[model samples]
Target: MHVKYLIIGAGPTGLGAAHRLTELGEHSVLVLERNPYAGGLAASFRDAAGFTWDIGGHVVFSHYTYFDNLVDALLGGEYLEHMRIARVRIAERWVPYPFQNNIRHLPPDMQWECVQALLPGHRREVAPTNFAEWFEYVFGAGIAKYFMRPYNFKVWATPAEMMSYQWIGERVSVVNLEMVLRNLVLQLDNVSWGPNNLFRFPQQGGTGEIFTRLAARLGDKVRLNTPVAAVDPASRAVHTADGQTITYDKLLTTGPLDILIRDQIGAGPAAAMVGDGMRAAAGQLARNGVYVAGVGVNGTRDDDTCWMYFPESNAPFYRLTNFHNYSPRNAARPGHQRALMAETSWSDHKPEQLDTLMDKTIEGLVNTSMLHPDETARIASRWSIAVDYGYPVPTPGRDDALRCIQPWLEAHGIYSRGRFGGWKYEAANMDHSVMQGVEWAGRMVLGEEETTYKL
Candidate 1:
């Protein structure tokens, strides 16, 4: 089968690209996915209890108007607006997210110590050499010691010094001292501007609904359970796992671009370069999340709070989500039922030790105060996904390596784009991933100005 564009990896990016193609009346397309359904890692599953669990906790918040327009066009009426009340739990305390900003509630000495770190005079001009240094430069050594350093290390699975600080806008909390003081006095401390600060949730199925809908729109055009073995860009023919050699004019690979290229072409010097291009950063999924477990409690909470984080050495998983608060449907049990989901992460993958991890995670949760040791609640289900490649570790060498190599691939008629495709962790969220695909397609179809994933 010959087509105008042969799209690989039937995730949001690929689906978004296809949508843009179809809207432009360029419908000669074929989407190939290794899985049977669309939505790649963001897909949803129906449990034995008839409740849907998003592969992990996927909370969608759109920063681009184009993205909003597309979602409204696709899943328009089904979307539900949610008021975000995310929090962070640290040192056996329920601190608000952006634990740094709203930390005035601590004991007087602790609060004074934190404030001393935040003083304007203490913040001198120091060009931070690394991510950790940047944190120290901005928040001062005091705050860094209390929360910034260890908490981040737990989450990123790498020392802050090992990573870069470029992706720090809108994502991290910058404490406006005046506002922080006012909130401290008023006792209202929450991350008020997080992208997820206030977002939308699909009334029914989790974030996976968005992709499922997109795939349905593509209909039979989306070929699933068909992993492409090799794509001979020379002849524009793609050989599938089941021996289907389909041809195309141009190929848009949303699969981690370098992997597809490297595997397609054997591991020679060029392939080695391709592999390096693909394996950007620390060559490790930095922010790996282990969903400790989700327990559906029979009763409601004292308050309506969202995801809470812990930034200390004591907690096994750094964060926990009252998944039910995001949407009423997150809970599988009856009305006012509570669903508590937690996560744990590691810097490397050791699949062999996962069975032991299950026991360890349970004990860790109890230790962290997220769960009570004495309370025997019905665990609706206990499951975990390695998340294959969770977060792109943005180390010091990341940007330089990617910049040096991405253009090389393009010279050979390949567009390496997407969270893993381009290998940019900062921009790898669902919105950015979909936009990467759409923008790549625009380049293919209309030769539009490229949207740099970095900026």
Candidate 2:
């Protein structure tokens, strides 16, 4: 089989690329997806008990107009727009999102602790060298100690010291002492701080509906259940596990960049072509695993909050989403049930007992006030999935490593993109992932410069 553009993994990136290619009057594009369905990590699944769950917590929010239009065209009137009501569970209180800006909600003593740490002389004046230092440098010791450090550790599953602070773009809300004090003194809530303050969700099918619709538009161009076994960049061909060799003029792989380089390319006949430096750079790339557990209860609550973050050890999960709130159809009984989805991250630095994770997640719900202790028996369904590649850790070496590896892959007419493929958490949002593909297609066909996943 031969194609002008062959994409691996029919996730948002692959589908976006193929769709754009077809839009640009290119018909020889093909997409290969390992899963039986599309959407990749953004995919949703309906459990046997009839509760819908996303891979993690994914909301439809974008930074680009092209992405906005594509989503509007794909989902149309089938989506629900929402004002983000995010919160953080800290010090036995529900502090508003951007915990640093809402410390006034904390206990008097704890509020003073946060304020004292932000005092002129208390904050370090030295330049930050890593994520941990950056937290202290930007948020001061109190906010960093109470929220930034622990919460980041729980989410990334790697010590902040081992990661870089460069990826902190709009993903983090940076606050100065003045803004913090103003909010604290006036008792203002800074909930509308980030890009996702206003987002969208499909009325049904969780987040995967957009991709399902997109893959449908591509027709036979997308091949499901086709996992790539090896890639011979020298020959510009991909060997699938089904024993089919597909050659491509240009290849876009949306799989993990490390696995694509190390397991596929480096282990294939073109191993010598990869060289030692790229392989080592591939090894330097790090990512944590995420376990998503959906707990469906027999009754719904009146809470309007969207999601809550957990930084304390009392909860096994780092974040919990009110899945039922995103779309009532997410629950089996709609208005009568609650779908509580929790996410826990794991890596070598932080090992979790997956076998007991579901139980731990349920216990976490009770600890975080998401569920009543007695409501445990009303649990109708418990569905869980663990993805090995979750958020790609932005280690200090990431940029240098990408500098070393991406150019070589591009030299071989291969573009590895998306969340894990690009290995950039900042650009790993649904919009960014899709736009990365759209930009890749634009660059290939229109000679346009790719902007989303720049090295």
Candidate 1 residue lDDT tens string, 1-92: 78888788889888888888887788898899998879987787656654556665678787788888878877777767777776666656
Candidate 2 regions with alpha-carbon error over 4 angstroms: none
State TM-scores per candidate. Answer: 0.89, 0.99
C-alpha lDDT (0 to 100) for residue 170 of candidate 2: 81
lDDT of each: 0.70, 0.93
Alpha-carbon error at 156 in model 2, in Å? 0.4
Best by lDDT: 2
Best by TM-score: 2
| Candidate 1, residue 344: how far the Cα is off, in Å | 2.3
